[model samples]
Target: MKQTRISVLAVFLVLAMATAALAATEVRMVGDALVYGSFFSNRNFTGWNAPAWTSATPTWSKAGKKTEEAFEIWERFRLRTDFVANEAVKFRLEMKVEDTWGHGTFTAANPEVAIMIYGAYLQFKLPCTDVDVTAGLQNVALPQSKMFYGSPVFGDRMAALVVKAPLIDKTLSVMAGYGRLIDTNRTYDTTTTQVADELDAYFLALPITLDGFKATPWGAVAVAGKDANLFTLKSSQQNSSFYADNLTSAGTYATPKLWKNDQNAFWWAGGAFEVSALDPVKFYADVIYGAGAESDRKKSHRSGWFMDAGVEYTGWDVLTPKAYGWWSTGEDGSTANGSERMPMIRPNWGPGNSFLFDDSQELVKNSNMGMSPVGSWGLGVTLDDVSFVQKLTHRLTFLFVNGTNSARAIRTLNTLMGSNPYFQMGRDLTINEHVYGVNFDNKYMIYENLSAVVETGWAHGEFQQSVWGHSLVNQSRNGDTWKVSFGLSYKF
Candidate 1:
């Protein structure tokens, strides 16, 4: 009887060990680094010393001193680690560090550099089914074509849960997600006992793919409490005001304020399509409509439409030529009727390497000279991947932008605010204003995973004094602006 009991215990232990071995986890890591220095002038299109020209009343540019030389170096690094338990389950974590060259170092007598958690998520396949689910913080974007980089409504990192299921193998699928945009500590609100200052969004997408064509139709809805944190929608560092003036009717354009209601509703619908049936000649396009509604405050509401299209020819062995254009509804003369500009949460849309918009810049940081095309229309052309020698390539681009917003709207806002509303002069233009830009960028592969880059761009602005007023226009030196950046990138 004693031997029989011992044999049974040994068998149990053996089975446990076998199960553990079968479930062994695999770990993988990937990362990238970038270091760059940028030399720029007239970054604001108003000279380098424009900051010293501020006053209670707008003054003339000649009364202030201006400079044209400025330089800075920036560095960024990111690492992602993935742990796979099997073909069915996985977990990923990403960390990032980005800042000026010498600011955040303990040895430099400053605060120690901070490491940020860029993403952390778990992904798994449902039991007895093909459905896939991902939960936690991750990068999210609405349905959009690659030509414009991402959606014009919301494209960034957020805490969310996403699920995807294939309806017809690899040809058709459906995706759904929920993202939390803001949370002002509802559980810890000391005043009013219960607070409703949170924002949440839900989305759905349908994707269809054929032999040489693909399309995705998507829609989203968000609920925002009246006191939701608006600052959460802005980038860590911005070239100019993000939604300040674009949220037109909230108050005045010069000093806009948010109007409140118990709860606000925002909705968006869009579609992205790509066609490659024509081989070397390919086409891509996206159309979107978005709106915000408030029950009590009519001036707090906004709605509009936006669309963009692009064509690319990849027949040549050394170069690919592309053309892109975009249009969107803009504000009119009335303030009580609310803004006509398309409502956006955090837009990340652009085309090519043009400096006028936040396109594909190897630097990615401190180089976004142009704001999102909220109330604007543009046309651009690019000659991409022009290689004349081994491991060396160049890209040249030219772009033109014109405002779609009415000048009368700005004029009225300035009068109501009793201040200069042209603070974002070159960034936010009127229908009577325009700007053109050119870019010449170069890249040389140092190794299979390393490259050297050089980017240069220039922009010229055309503004009308009749719309912006002499005081604001004279205070701004709206001459040409330019920049030259050199950088190195390494990846594995």
Candidate 2:
């Protein structure tokens, strides 16, 4: 027994020495915590995700199974730690925890433990060179205007190896990387010896900066296997991968079928530019074109163009006003020629702090109500940082959008796929449909690292019966959408 105790002590001593050595390296941490409560009415505005109309429920419900107003409180926390050995090398690790207040089996006494790894990567410069390399799981976003936050085609986190090299001192640089989005063979069934269904993407960008202007031209291509997992899943308005489903040329949603080709290719090219030569007057813009999956059936192919621009005036002391506009090619009358909507891996684009689109939000689980800027166009005006009180600020915005999809095309899809939750009447609008909204957001600082936030919005949808049919129109007529959220955020 004494010998065993001695061995255990030796193990502990070794571990302590290792931990002390690691502490010698510089370590830093940054994180944020958020808690929020939300109350929303008529979130389903029209057809998508709403419960069926019946005597039991008069108003629109947020989900098919629920017949009540959507209300919930959620919380989340994120922490990122960096271990730096020198100016040229560092390792990053990020983790997160999030959940609804009381919906799950989690309780005060028996809490569920769920900690997710958000990022883990190593960043280092090459020896005797100016080149920088980042390898491992990390955030990836194609080049796009800063005003839009990130690329509309693809923006998310994935495992990748990226390299950046300087070419002309401070004038130009290049970035390139490769990412694997899906590997079904390993993800689902590793024992089977069948062909691997994989999806991989490659990206390249050239960033140029001058005295008063900056621009980035980027391109990306992806290869997908015939049995990629993205095609097998049920289509949903919440998931962008539904765009990969084989849509019939006649605008009908069909069951997943085998494709003629063993492999498919998707590509995108775009450029983003910012002009600040006028100082207080600045301009930002991005243009992108994408196409995907050329198979024997035209239904499997999709292609389109998207562009957005914004102008901001920062000369005012109390506020900065901005105007933004966007446009994209929409679906035509026929599905056989393929959809005119741009294909996206994952989109994280939005202008201003509009609640109608999936813009990043300060509160947890309070946004992304199935509105995306894929086949639509809109305009918005924002008064940002309007402050009259100390430690407090407010923002006001007005935004409107009009659908570009042909009315006939929408009618055809609804007639055949009306029961499919993926085809929402108001959320997926026709050329004759439109929506408008206004938002009032406020923030008050309690401390340097803590703040209280409140956001409220109202939206109205106009869906023509001639295009959406009587049933859909009736469901959509419940009322305008309204939402209010209050939250507290702490950063360190």
Per TM-score, the best of the predicted structures is 2
RMSD of every candidate to native, in Å, equals 9.5, 6.4
lDDT (10s digit) by residue, model 2, range 1-492: 454455456546634644664866777779999889888777767423442322111112223444444787878888887878899999897877777787432345555555667798999999999999999899888998887776777777889999999999999999999998777676565456555477788999999999889999999998877555654432232342243432222232443433456677889999999999998999999999988766546766778899999999999989999999999988898765667877777676777777776665566375545565767899999999999999999999898999888877666655655534334555566778888888889999999999999988888898878765676577668778888999999999
Q: What's the lDDT of the predicted structure labeled candidate 1? A: 0.74
Q: lDDT of all the models against the reference?
A: 0.74, 0.74
Among residues 3 or more apart in sequence or in different chains, the pairs in candidate 2 whose N, CA or C atoms overlap within 3 Å are 249-335, 249-336
Q: Residue 253 error for model 1, in Å?
A: 7.4
Query: How far off is residue 228 in model 1, in Å?
Result: 1.7
lDDT of 1 by residue, 1-492 (tens): 354355456445634644564557777779999999987777656653322213212222331245644787878888787778889998887877787766663225544546677898999999989999999999888889888887778777789999999999889999999998778675676586576667788999999999889999999998766555543334322434433233324332223345555567888999999999998999999999888764546666788899999999999989999999999987787766777888777667788878777656787776756555778899999999999899999999998999988887766765554333233456667888888889899999999999999999898887767665564466454557778999999998
Sequence-dependent TM-score of model 1: 0.86
